[model samples]
Target: MKDESLIFGTRAIIEAITANKSIDKLFIQKGLQGELSRELMSLVKKNNITFTYVPVEKLNRLTRNNHQGVVAYISPIDFYDLENLVMNVIESGKTPLFLILDQLSDVRNFGAIIRTAECTGVDGIIIQKKGGAPVNADTIKTSAGAVFKIPICKVDHIKDAMFYLQGSGIQVVAATEKAESTIYDTNLTIPSAIIMGSEGKGISPSVLKLVDQSAKLPMYGDIASLNVSVACGVILYEAIRQRL
Candidate 1:
């Protein structure tokens, strides 16, 4: 209904899939039995596109015009290749500062962190392919267009990302409330990657184990933790402070 939400015909949707466009989700009217529908389903499966089968009435509600029982939500931001971005950063003869999000699902929080990460000169942001917020217009607006300026790498898993970063000579630091050390005391001057977890659960145990170091922000208030985005700012700026 909103301008941010767009509807595409079946051919346009297929073109989007073929073009590797960032798609948040796709919708197909339920019980649309056809050869073209089978091909669409095959493409969706191949591309790992998230889609929902809904009643034709719901499709009509989404768009007044003929949607051909198909519509897709396109994402505003483009993802980067993690390994290439890292290699480029290293080849530039500068220390790489990467931020990794472990299962962070809140869209606004993610946007806020991108804004901070960009300001702090973070080289890139890494997020898991699944269990993360879809990058949409809200993220772009909330980031104040930082999403365009900063590189975001979507990875298959957090642990795999940690492994690659570590193997590449960057220290992997896990930010968690459970850490024994405070971020203020930890050393961040080295080329490093920081992992920020979800709002509810902290970093996954498997991921935490792979980190080179674990640190947390000191809590002095009644609340046990700060919002993920707020914590990201404190930690990232602290890194910037330490580097400068």
Candidate 2:
């Protein structure tokens, strides 16, 4: 983590928020209470920023400086508005192909997915504001700077995003091993969005319920599942192959 990507101290974090800086996540010391803390909390609620309360040791580990019970990670890339992105793609006369990620926290996997999405000419990538991986230095490096080339949108919830995509006439397909059909069976050449979930919990049941279709890669080996990034590549390229 680079020091340039962090804003420390209560007042500093508050100023960053006031300035409308893209904050990936906020960390506050547990049991922190004061007028400043209350004000910060109000701003966090108003801005819908994600935060976590941690021990003082965690703050100390992040920085030896006087952090004043607060640390905010700054996002390297600015997020896009989903509706605007969808409208733009439609206006361009291009079939919109989006990738929606559900609680994918691993930085490397997230980066790899972005890289593949960019190569596949995906219109955008949507993720939850809270549970998704932060666009940090590691993510940028892992993506080979493709993170900057892609339009990534942060939504309040993945389920809501799926609804919006479906409403816009895009088919929402989920990649999960539980599905009986293979990715090759799913038609991806049309306006569509693919939902990739976390490694531990596949896709959330609530979001999966909204998907128009579900498809999976055939696994013949001893391993039950492929890495999330590799699976993402497989599905995205399938879309690319169909479109080509």
For each of the candidates, the C-alpha root-mean-square deviation to the true structure, in angstroms, is 2.1, 1.2
Runs in model 1 lying further than 4 Å from the true structure: 1-5, 29-32, 52-61
lDDT of 2 by residue, 45-124 (tens): 99999899999999999999999999989898888999999989989999999999999989999989999899989999
TM-score of each: 0.90, 0.96
Q: Lowest-lDDT window of 10 residues in candidate 1?
A: 1-10
lDDT of each: 0.88, 0.92
Q: List the residue pairs that clash in candidate 2.
A: none
Off-target runs (Cα >4 Å) in candidate 2 are none
Residue 176 lDDT in candidate 2: 97
**Residues 39-94, model 1: lDDT tens digits:** 88899999877678888888788788778889888877778999999999999999
lDDT of 2 at 90: 89
Query: Which TM-score value belongs to model 1?
Result: 0.90
Candidate 2 — number of clashing residue pairs?
A: 0
